[model samples]
Target chain A: MLSTQENAIIIEDLKKSFKNLEVLKGVDLTVRRGNILALLGPNGAGKTTIIRILSTLLHPDNGNVFVNGFDIKTQPQEVRRSIGLTGQFADVDEYLTGLENLLMMGKLYHLSRSVITRRTEELLKKFDLTEAARRPVKTYSGGMRRKLDLAASLIAYPPIVFLDEPTSSLDPRSRLNVWETIKKLLNDGVTVLLTTQHLEEADFLADTIAVINDGRIIAEDTPGRLKSRVGKERLELVIKRQDDFERAVTVITGNDLSHNSAEKTVSLAIENGVNEIQGVLNQLAESGIEVDTLTLRKPTLDDVFMHFTGLKPDEGRNEAA
Target chain B: MNSQLVYKKAYWMAGDVWVLIVRSIKHIYKNYDQLLGLTIQPIMFMLLFRYVFGGAIVVDTGTYVNFLMAGILVQGLAFGSLTTSFSIATDLQRGIIDRLKTLPIASWAVMMGHVTGDLVRNGLQAFILISMGILVGFQPTASALEWIVIAVLIVLFTLAISWIAAIMGLLAKTIESVSWLGFLVIFPLSFASSAFVPTETMPAPLRVFAENQPFTHVIEAIRALTLNRPVGNHLWMALVWCFGIILVSIPIAGYLFRRHGGR
Candidate 1:
């Protein structure tokens, strides 16, 4: 269990209103140390606003925030020294080279000359931009640019880093690389507050996930725990032929597997989970329905979000603003 | 804050500024043509004025080159400082300045670094204009120290204006408006001073306008030092002008940045 006191980041009763609309309404959260806390929210759920307060860039209209034991309102410098932020947009100078960006970030951290040099060399290699390090960032591919942004965030080795959609535009290869880097940060015991719309990213990387909608967190839990709360297993059946969909459903439900066929394939919420799934498969084979594929997997974050937000991840994000 | 604490703060603060500069320079290095614009324009203006304006215009100094050189250098420094404003606006638009909001560095360092870049940029503009000045017929009787003081003063002057321009940039709504914004700043400040012609030759009301304006003092101080003439009160007046701009624009820019700039 993570202690509410020992958590690296804590927000209590965070409230902010702009004229008539309230962006954050009495929000509370505790991000445990050495864990990746993915702050999942639709637009206007106040993710950026919360990030601003925790980074000491903005003060909340009401409530308090503590980052790395420093009160953001009173001890801004201490808080600043402790955290790293990579915003949703890449704010890097398009004219600067990949290597220059890291060195400059190193300079901001007040690293000595030799240390900056070593750190720069290390980041270039780590971010896999060794060849492109000297090229101006404007010439870099989108993946390379995002990696540079991520590398810049880590140059200081901050104990806590806030990454808002860090890998949104990255290709799968680069996205996986970013995931691996994030995993490495977890091993090093650095706390990460990540806000991302990519459900798969959250599903794989976040140890603790918070689903925020309408300026409030509707649900918060581990991926598996959150999935279990939906109260059923997800069984996806792929039909070998379009006409076989109805026949497969009869076999699945006949084995006491409750299911919904919303689209191309039929799904079931089964009992004894895998045992029910196994029985359905045997019956389908015996019935000669020629089912193409059958698999049993837990509900993903997408399903969990769908259950809470009443919309898919992309829909929730678009509708948020 | 104690001296040690302040130094520590400023030293760490320099990182944000330093990083911005290094990155900007790398940008400059990549686009050599942009730098070519810096060199090409003054050379064209030098040729245009010296050859065309040379035959008709007459100063007691006899050669039009001397008079033309000073004016070109002054105008180039003023114009060169405008790019700082453009770059600042671009950075703001691109969210580079927005990112700085999240750093641990001193709040003012980002603006300070940008103004310092103007200082350095104007210094380079000074160099190009001077080398071109000599290539015409302008001569300087002062030693290296005099030139250094004059150089520092020009930089300080450019920095003051860049601060003003930067404030305008942060406040501007769109990038297209940046050029117009810069133009608005320069139009009044440039023409109100002795940059174009001597104040004595102007009509009475215009002379008062020129004499009362801060630009006049800057031009007078610059002309006195570079031309090896007596500075008199122009030095004091120039300092007053530079200090006044810094005192006002820095705070105003900081305020605007804090308010509208992303948290």
Candidate 2:
């Protein structure tokens, strides 16, 4: 038996393979109670595989997973009782009304009839789906469907929830709406494990971010610390003339600068971006080099991701998405 | 786990199955056109065989319409149960099965719910065909008690075939494939058997295969029951076939349902 002090989820040396492709390779993760752990990765990086194993939707080839004090392999029913899963695609029945969907989930959870009714209303209202609650979900907008999916997961209020790319394929405004809904889960003290390829999503929503690549967690830390590992800030200079790029590179030397000849730009990692930009500008001005644009960029999760994975976060994602 | 906890879990599974059944039935109700189309096909077949082809094809039974009604009900129930495959395939495609698997209820509940719902729908289809048969100058000479037994037999046969449909739905890669698979099996079984035409009119080899199949026994049994004739060995054969299907398909459907995650 596990106590409440134990982590909400513990996965150790987890491995899974689908036919010829090895999806998860010896993954180890611990999500603390009442916190959000974002499994950040590009497409086919084993993020969904890991989420499926943890949620007991798919079995692992080897290793152990414990969710909310129960083993996922042997005590899957108990684990299921304690965890709610919102899959990548919305899982609510499109033929059922939004209210009926929630009620169905509540009944599946074995909640009493009266409690199911109350919770159904509460969740519909909480997700701001009260107006569309009576309509079949096929008539709902994409964002409404997502909200209903999330609400269905919360029907029983499980201590842990798995959001597998919950906001994928949604418009920007809808994505923000989902992000706000996820934020409310934090206040309710639910342990959330979300997967996303969106670096901005991880930076904004995750309390701890696990960077996965090639079926392994390459880096794991808070969003801020992960960004700091790459650099504090970036200094970007777009030279007006291609001829002046070589001279600008010399002035920006010793600052770990990289030049893109095609774009006529040079970027460098800097500790004090403002000071470094001023120094580079003065030096370039002295050499009679024209500058088109000069700016300091705060290090984003993309930089941290690239620094760890040696590939752009969006490199192999567009085709898959 | 404690016995009480196990009981509670079983109770939850039962409740979950009920919810899924209601959901499926409500979907069928909302798509009443599809239901109407399904129920109408058997009635049309009954009319075609009774009026259109009745004069040419002769059977030893008292009235050809009486002989055709039993086979029509069996064929209709078999075809009605095919909806189980289509609906299950749709649920698998839509990720509803994946969502249900993650819940605390028994995994078998998903398939059971589907079969149960199809069983109800099959019952309704049987009723519609029987009512139409009565309206078209057909009569059953069996007593009320035997009629009840015939109804029970139809329901049992439908329940068994539904398990097979569940397996097809689970094994199918696409929704369209499910329909094709159902057609591949149901069409051969219903047409080649004595559902529409008697086996004597067929060639000897085809006659042997048709007479030996489960659909022939079920149709023969239902024909005997409704005509107040001795059931002979066909009733036992029908019961055996129904039990055999349920015995073989329940485990296979459960395994395939578990295997086919939202893949």
Candidate 3:
């Protein structure tokens, strides 16, 4: 529905199949430069397949991928040059000291010995990892390895970087630390293409969010816009009397009641405004349905994802997004 | 920071594989105890076969250690080179390769790094084996220039065998499976060539097969240098054998490496 020429990453009609399984079926993605494009998807939704193609690790059976205005198939090395990828599990060599991992990446990027050395120190300071720089990576905590992984990717500071669930396994505080680093990168004008299943992550970091389900994008919008699609906030109530509940449903359903179930004891969905609650109580009081409970809140992104995908992701894929 | 910097940085990464080489070395250094077997196992084989079995078999009327050690050195390289291939397989199984696969430098650099690293490793094993043989009274008969010829011959043979091992590593479905599969190559080559004794001591038909084998010529070429004997037609034959393995194994390994990962 939209097109951008100067985009950092553009994927069109991308289809990839393995043997009999069609992992990605006609997917399209366009990531604006310098913005964090959050690719949110449930497990097995072909998120990694998409990332691999964009990063030039895999090729699509059909369609074209353009990274920094270069075709991935024809100019893969150039595409690779324009992007850095940090995978689901940070595959830093565990035997190497954390400092050595970053330095090694800097060297692999072909910075001069002096340049790689400089970048190594800079990244260590930036990631707040200098304190543990000499420790073997295996000794570092999950969060530290992730931080080191991020620091290593920035050795060359490619314009676009792909982070595959860089924070999925992190504890809240460490996750927050990673978020701060990502924010710093954004401030530095680095474009991040992040694939994550955490709705909160997308909410906290995304400039745009695309919800993928069953190998296709089901929805794409700003986080707030996606949440708003779940409809107006409401007070849900379960009462004692069935007749009174029926009456309450009739009364509340008369207004802005979004698809509720009255079959259960006294359930009434009403817009979550005080006026609406007061209006429902007056109607319920007249019908003699003694109210048991009532609560009101705005819908969460979980609700939005649940609504669109028809089911919430019951099992999170432990691997990075 | 800018497009100019990105390509420039990636261009530079390819030239700095030494850091990765160092990392590989450090990994080995850390696990020094575990690799003691890699360094010493071949030495034990040399001592045992050179002493116990040495006098039993004769190839060209020389110290059997000198003759058989040539073949043993060839066999040792063939054995040691598989470690490189298996290490690649292990890296893949451990998801290490997956991380490197996404890096910005030349994608093929990972394979190159592994191959170079393996050559270093194979070179070490060859040196240790050669040094031990030198200590056991094995002397070089060839002059310095001829010695260089034999060293070049050994390097080529090792490279070819390493490529085949690399192919096996890439195609095997599981790391454990590949590790076990690689051992199969070692046995036949070691037993069928002049590595343990000499091709002459074998039963007639077995001797014919042994003499016809590429490894037989490789060992013969090494034997000629060690004893300062005339390098029979086997010298040319050894070079041809090494080139043949390289021609066949490289494309096969390259195809499989790309098939498994170059996607």
Q: What is the C-alpha lDDT of each candidate?
A: 0.74, 0.84, 0.75
Question: Scoring each candidate complex against the real one, what DockQ results?
Answer: 0.42, 0.46, 0.39
Residues A138-190, candidate 1: write the lDDT tens digits.
89887777778877887787889898877776789878887887777777788
TM-score, predicted candidate 1 vs. hidden true structure: 0.79
lDDT of 1 at A151: 78
Clashing pairs in 1: none
| Candidate 2 Cα deviation (angstroms), residue A143 | 1.3
Q: Which ranges in model 3 have alpha carbons more than 4 Å from their true place?
A: A1-6, A61-64, A73-75, A112-115, A169-176, A228-305, A312-321, B1-35, B50-64, B90-105, B136-142, B200-205
Candidate 3 has an interface RMSD (Å) of 2.3
At residue B139, candidate 2 shows an lDDT of 89
Worst 10 residues of 2 chain B by lDDT: B254-263
Model 1, C-alpha of A87: deviation from truth (Å)? 3.2
Candidate 3 RMSD computed on C-alpha atoms after optimal superposition onto the true structure:
5.8
Candidate 3 lDDT over residue span B1-263, tens digit each: 99998886665664656556676667666656636767787788888888887767665646777776787788777777776677678777755676666665554456666666667777777778888989997877778888788778878887887788888888888988886788887778777877776566689999998888888888888887778788889899999989999899878876777677546
Candidate order (lDDT): 2, 3, 1
Evaluate residue A60 in candidate 1 and report its C-alpha lDDT on the 0 to 100 scale: 84
